[model samples]
Target chain A: AQTVTQSQPEMSVQEAETVTLSCTYDTSESDYYLFWYKQPPSRQMILVIRQEAYKQQNATENRFSVNFQKAAKSFSLKISDSQLGDAAMHFCAYSFNFGNEKLTFGTGTRLTIIP
Target chain B: SQTIHQWPATLVQPVGSPLSLECTVEGTSNPNLYWYRQAAGRGLQLLFYSVGIGQISSEVPQNLSASRPQDRQFILSSKKLLLSDSGFYLCAWTGGPGETQYFGPGTRLLVL
Candidate 1:
């Protein structure tokens, strides 16, 4: 079974600073996908960023980017220029590259933006 | 662009009562759909997924069951509810396997 882990249970960063949330996974499959999802107090699960295992280049969306280390089995999310709106619960998830696979999610990291 | 939606934003039901949650997708056809449950302070758990209108695959064995009667519609139902079943239920969809799954706003279910 594939598993995703977010070592940091909670994290805080000052406004305008950069925060990197750590994530690692255990998978025997050679091809897969990693994702970071954000859930605010409203309980909406919003997709933050996604990284494909086959892609050597990492994924970046606006202020959100990932440092994907496939050999190390690590996928960390970096939030740059953090704003108040960035405060939320972040979840790391995994899915297989083929078949109708389900996403296996980590426990989540609660992010607090100290302004 | 495609969008996913789940109904009954919030619900409170007594034990042994039935449950019915609906999810629909717009601007997409024959997309893969999924049902997930997030227990308080826990990660999201995949309950079921469907690749087509009538094909449903369950990830975990539980009191819940899912059905896809239409190409863009999925339903989660339970014959009887339990207190342990209380949680925030989320519906998601993707174009296919390995694709980024988009989530709905989620429905909060509280069984007392």
Candidate 2:
């Protein structure tokens, strides 16, 4: 079984500043996918960024990027130029590379973008 | 563009009452469907997932059961509800296993 851990339960960042949310996972599977999801008060899950275990290069999507260290089993998300809209609960999830593998999520980190 | 719709946006029921939540997807076929439960201030927990019609995989052993009657429709049902079942239920779909999932607005169920 794979377990995801988000050591930071709460985080705050000033507007326009950068923030990094930490995530670590324990998985024996060599082929897997890692994701970061955001859920605001609306309770809708939004995909932030993704990283494949095989990819040595990190994944970046606009302001959101991931620092994936496969050897360390760490995948952290970095939000650059953070805005008030970035205030939400962020979750780190893991899944297999195969068909319909269910996602295992971390406890979550509540992010507050301070203005 | 694809979208997922989950119904009754909010629901309130008494303990031991029966429950049913419907979820449907549009603009996609043979997609993987999933049901998740979110407790207050907690991350989404995978309850059930379906890869095809009449096939359901339950991740957590709970009072709820899921059924995929059609390729694009998934339903979560409970014969008798429990207070522990009170939470936000979210429906999600993905193009494949490794693909990112798109989630619905979620149904807020409160069992009193």
Highest-DockQ candidate = 2
- Cα lDDT of model 2 by residue, B1-112, tens digit: 8999999899999999999999999999999999999999888899999999999999999999999999999999999999999999999999886788889999999999
Against the native complex, each candidate's DockQ, computed on alpha carbons, is 0.81, 0.82
**Cα DockQ of the candidate 1 complex:** 0.81
Highest TM-score, which number? Answer: 2
Model 1 chain B: lowest-lDDT 10 consecutive positions = B92-101
Candidate 1's residue-wise lDDT over B46-94, tens digit each? 9999999889999999999999999999999999999999999999999
RMSD of each: 0.9, 0.8
Question: What docking tier does model 1 reach?
Answer: high
Give candidate 2's chain B TM-score.
0.98
Candidate 2 falls in which docking quality class?
high
TM-score of each: 0.98, 0.98
DockQ for the candidate 2 complex?
0.82
Worst 10 residues of 2 chain A by lDDT: A95-104
Please identify model 1 stretches exceeding 4 Å from their true place: none
Clashing pairs in 2: none
